[model samples]
Target: MIRDMAKGLNFPEEATAFLGECFDKITALEDGNDQLALAMDAFFASKDYASILNRLAEQTGIHRYSVDMVFLLLCADSLHDIYYIKELPEELFHNTMMDLKCKLLECKALHGIWGTFVTDWLQGYFHLKRYALGRLQYNTIEFPYEDYKGILKKGDRVLSCHIPSGAPLLIEDVLDSLKQAYAFYPDELRDGVLPITCHSWLLYAPHYEVFPEHSNLRKFYDLFTVIDNEATEGSNLDRIFNVTETDDYSTLAETTTLQKRFKKYLMDGNVMGEGFGILLFDGEKIL
Candidate 1:
């Protein structure tokens, strides 16, 4: 099952085999082990995932993140059952589950391992509160801004769109994802329009200074009506550069053009921050 899921998520053959080995070890360790059994139960019950994860690491002598991957694979059956009960499309489920492989790649890039630190974030998938629709991920969120309410009021149902890593945020793909969100959540639409909100560093206005006119990031930033910008202590350096730490910016790699530009931007005493924006999509297009 782990191998099948790994393949479904397009995991490399080496990663697939390693995950299978972890699964086998975990299965063998589960029988007649009361403590291990308790931890597994707690994991499935959504009780203290960190503690369960730590316990698994101690018991199995495996890296915490590798255990995390195995645990996610263990929960695959239940997640599938939830998707089935919700009657969501299989493609949607696959796209959402693809986040696992994405995060694994991120872990490999950052730490040279096949694991994830965002197991808590993955809970939304198991709970059915999030979906991946093409180039974006959407989670149901109440309109969080009260200070500048226009068409959307506080506590109103809104889809919070997130730009997941691993893809160029092309305009066409983003538009298609918005269209899918409009069709997927008929109940959440207001007057045939889907209200979407985003809060991410990509929307940070200052990034435009470094982004070229035709850069995809800049293009995506222009899609929303930004309402707020706030200073952040640290930037998304880890995400942007695939490095685990950002304390010493001098060590950051400049593999991509954006990376080179952003490194210079940071070195020149500029700060990275986040912005909040809203978009109203009227089924066919953004209104």
Candidate 2:
């Protein structure tokens, strides 16, 4: 019973419809004979990915703490479904899903200043806007504060917004600078690429900032190539570090697929690895 499934996982009554829908889809798989990997393939192959991600972000109200877990569970199900040939039983299947859900509630998705600031500010800004305004209205303006707002507003109005004591720092300022150029290019980024880029920047930016003595953003310089070809040397940090530098779609596709496959492999472990091996061996045999 999915009710048991939800109760076992401590999921709220609000998730009843959502979890029921997921369970219904999983149960619909060939009347209990379908394997886990196939079910996941079917799930991901369908519109579930966008739906679940959208729920993780908006409906579930768990973006801050539960999102990483949802992401992990998403790939986990996908990889396991792609690798495991065995059909999961109702109990185990429900249990695994519940465990994944519970695990998500415990996962730490944020890593850098973005993580810290988003937790304190972004969530607060969205959840408690009036409170944030009360705090930020009369303090010294921060870098990314002025920067990100401009991008979000699509205007270049310099803010005199003051930061209150113990206020969140302007992590979005750096993100804003990066946003200026990539305004709406990668639709995914505009949609739900927050974690990817936030994690990337969190890993890179601090070293470039406070401890310039100990870090080098240039370590990642070659990763991106300017598509314009006229990109100059040392024009600006953001432009210099643009990921869209290259004009090669193949390179971009390969890079993206490689990252996706690797992430799948990492999340799903030997399941994905063995699946790949079987695919390779089967292809060789057919050849």
Q: Report the number of the highest-TM-score candidate.
A: 1
TM-score of each: 0.93, 0.21
Task: Give the RMSD in angstroms, all C-alphas superposed, for model 1.
Answer: 2.0
Candidate 1 C-alpha lDDT tens digits along 97-209: 99998888888888888878788888787778888998999998878777444667788777899888887889999999998888888988876778889999988888877
Poorest 10 consecutive residues of model 2 by lDDT?
272-281
Clashes in candidate 2: how many? 8
List residue ranges in candidate 1 displaced over 4 A.
30-45, 147-149
What clash count goes with each model?
Answer: 0, 8
Candidate 1: worst-modelled 10 consecutive residues by lDDT: 31-40
Candidate 1's TM-score: 0.93
Q: What local distance difference test score does each model get?
A: 0.81, 0.29
* Model 1 clashing residue pairs (backbone): none
